[model samples]
Target: MDKFPIHIAFNFVFLRKKITGIRVHAIELFRALEEQKETKYIFHVITTKEGADILNEHGIRANGGIKVHIIASSFEKETDRLKLQLFSLNNTLKQNRIALLHCFDYLTPLQRPAYAKIIATIHDLIWLENPNTYSLPKRLFKKVFFSHSIRKADALIAVSKTSKESLIQHYGHGYDQKTTVIPNGLRNTFLTIKKQGNPERLIKGEYIIAVGRYLPHKNYERLIKAYAHCNTKAQLVIAGSDMDKSVDLQRLAQELGLNDKLLLLKNPTDAELISLISHASLFVMPSLTEGFGLPLLEAMSLSTPVLCSDIPVLKEVCENAALYFNPLSIEDMAAKITYALNSSPILQKLIENGHERVQAFSWENSAKQVMNLYDDLLLNY
Candidate 1:
């Protein structure tokens, strides 16, 4: 009963140091799938030098059915002009003669080997939702890339049910059947059965925490503006990477005379994040749009009281475990945060509900679903 190795390429080319929901999804799912690492399935992970370190930590190496290929750069820029290589995947596809190419990011190669079946994980159709958040080039690239990949891909994995529906609604025709809703899962550390958090880098006193990179779609600016109006005395701590680069979040806080009350920690390590989340009085998710609100689930897992946007994705992830607010209305967000912090009964209920809600999501569960999808896709091929 000898079985041939099925070659599959994991497109981690675009992963950078900045921690986003996509990076978390890819790494966590892979970690869960790592338990089944053997010769039955060959994993060709194409990634950058930094990404390799993350993968290597999970007992992943080139010795087994896994082969790690480190590239110099994901994609070389030529004076802001887009290239056809599409994260340098086409050549890799052709050279490796890959049977199935799984794209963790939103993009797939514009040109790839004919035999290669593409399975792209679409996080969200945020570009279609918020045209102003992206520049003309990015918007155009996303529209073209999304359309081509959705139409061409053998199957698409949407991060949430809402994301799946968004694909069908906007992309239209031949999308609903192919797209599968596979929600992101939390790390074991966050589970109440395990440990809520590791005390790595401790920030003093109680604080209201929010985690996300400094991106326009993340809606940090509005959150900061809302924080100014809140009556709560809790420190506003934003543990996002590269906040100093993307937007002047600190200066915004300063303009509102919140210099002492606001703490902006850039690129906090995972242990630090766990400590922050576990100890926080409240965790706020003020995203204008998201495919799946991973942070909301993470907060719930850590037993932190959740105050987030009333967006469908956030609701879908946290369910009734969170207090909701209008993402657009700064006043609503401020009021919600203040109320959540002040209300002991509600916050306690959220923490209790959080423990129960998080039981449904796990890396193991997500990995199982992914393996099932992989088996089905490979069976046809």
Candidate 2:
């Protein structure tokens, strides 16, 4: 069988099938490719049931205007799941015409001998940081899988300059030749939705909004405490799917006597989220670590002024377009919130700046870069 020039299959080895940052990138890339009628490319995605469902909901499939393949497998352990994914991708490639394999993570042993030119996108530098953040078994697993993935990938695409630097620091190779920096693209739907719901609700009160999964890394616990010290009239609304470990955060909110002021909403629709972000007096991100913070851009695209942590990656993404608050200092966070609440002029300027800055990034532009990269690699081969 003659392989197509851009028959690329992306593999993200996992059984959880969460629509995380990696999955979002995969979907957006395909969406961008599908829009270009002149490009003859087929982007197949091998994932689990949940991932397939997500793509299906977005109308992306092999039969639905874009070429996508969903390889389903069930395995409990991470290593075994990866091994299963490797075997599946290998079988799929053998039966079909595939020239490129763009894997989100590293390939397993079964995929190593395949003839496809591989391009791997590293979503984070998880291995560079201390392993003590997770349990003993997880630490051991990271030591194996993360290290192996980086070593084996033909071309490494980092989602941000920070991630690229972290990869060079940890892997000791692929700094110049194989590694490339491509920032994560923002979805346009966040800005397209016209904010029209209850006008009465809009006039209810001014509040700050924070959105993310209820994970420890998001540092919502600290955010709630920090918000407690803000103006009594200004409320903080934390919205996300309550994770397995988020019960502690809820308890912390109660302990801080913020049961009424702090609102916890679970898994809101994108429209609802956008409304919240658009109407928010301030959008804050107090994450301890992030590969690329998508919410910061989403808020900015909605013309919402952002108050994010003073972390390097956040600063890199937000630039001088956002107001920064020290993540370590509750005093600083509270003060920023207070300042925003007290000054209408500052709020207007920040929102304008945020809107202007976020215009530079788009899913279409990201997709174009990825497609062009594919063409270049194919020519080289």
Candidate 3:
């Protein structure tokens, strides 16, 4: 008998983990399905009402007669949370004859025993590498559960080669055969804003931009300190949500005497973010670690000159398209910021190269590759 076309159930167990990157991934996955008539596919976005609302706002609702499955699990403890996730997913799996189950969370495979292809995307390596990044008890539980999940997954996806290496080094004790390297893609808004170049939103080319949640790994402190010491001509506009409630970063900015220079615009809209990046003199990502820095690509796609930490993931993603700065060394960040502010010719060259580099990564391309993977699994399973 001829093989049946693959059907994917994208299990988003933790919808609040939703961010710009995940949104782009989902949209692209659906768009690719729409275009590929030979390879018939269906997407069951297993999320909550809030998650569905986010997708709807982004204009990715129920395309091609696809439906979003809203799953609810009322649990407060870590152990209970895992159990609920497993139970909810078990029900989802039994209800749908899904050929492949791809999940952003770790417990999808543990719950669904029926799927021929079980894949999980490991979006970050911090849980294994740096336990302190998470709460003590939560980290302990995650280490065990995440390790178990990886071993159980029929396939594991690492968003970047660095992320792949990190997974292998940390969790490849018995799951080496299951891992695959697939880079994340930037959203269409990135390309759209670049093409249209909305003048009203564009700055008069007087500021530098930094984007990311105010998390420790983002290293916003270093950026603020560096900006304080760097050339004074350009203001530093920091855009993103303050996911952490501490407001320690805000205090740090004030302490550095950068109160007037640092602009903290929290959780700006996509249009606002695009406008910020498109007009900035430079885009700085001082993140100490990332699975794949999507913001790096987003900024680069908008033809913004970028300066990121010289970490493996950022280097792999940005190549020579960005200026590299030492994440920990505030002095080095300061020096690079100074150079970027002072050298117009160098910055212009970086902008041009950035535009060229970003073209290589697209949501449609990523989704198509994922579909191909799904079809391959179904055919050869």
Best by lDDT: 1
Q: Which candidate gets the maximum TM-score versus the true structure?
A: 1
lDDT tens digits by residue: candidate 1, 1-381? 123677888877666666777888888787687775545788898876666776677455676667888764443452211342264667877777688888886677778887778889989888889777778988887888778778888889998899988888886857888987787888654554335335553877778999987778888889989999987678989887876784477778779998899888889767778888878889999998988877777788777899888988888888889999999999999888888877899999999988888888888887788888888887856
C-alpha local distance difference test of each model: 0.79, 0.72, 0.73
Q: Using lDDT as the measure, what is the rank order of every candidate, best first?
A: 1, 3, 2
Q: What lDDT tens digits, residue by residue, belong to model 3 across residues 71-166?
A: 753334446546655666667766766667877645654666454478877777776665556788878777777877787787877778887788
What digit string (tens of lDDT, one per residue) describes model 2 on residues 1-381?
A: 454445666664452544466666766666776786344566666676655666677766566334545565455666667556656677776565667777765444346435677787777765346343467876676677776766776677888888878777777765657887777777645545644432124324878889888765677877887888876576788877654456787788889888777777777767677778878888999977778888888888777889988987889999977888888788888888888778888888888888788887787887777777777777744
In order of listing, the candidates' clash counts read: 0, 0, 0
User: Which 10 consecutive positions of candidate 1 have the poorest summed lDDT?
Assistant: 76-85
TM-score of each: 0.91, 0.89, 0.90
Candidate 3 RMSD computed on C-alpha atoms after optimal superposition onto the true structure:
2.9
Stretches of candidate 2 above 4 Å error?
A: 1-6, 12-18, 37-39, 64-66, 73-83, 105-113, 130-133, 194-204
Candidate 3 displacement at residue 75 in angstroms: 8.9
Q: Candidate 3: global Cα-lDDT?
A: 0.73
Q: What is the lDDT of residue 116 in candidate 2?
A: 71
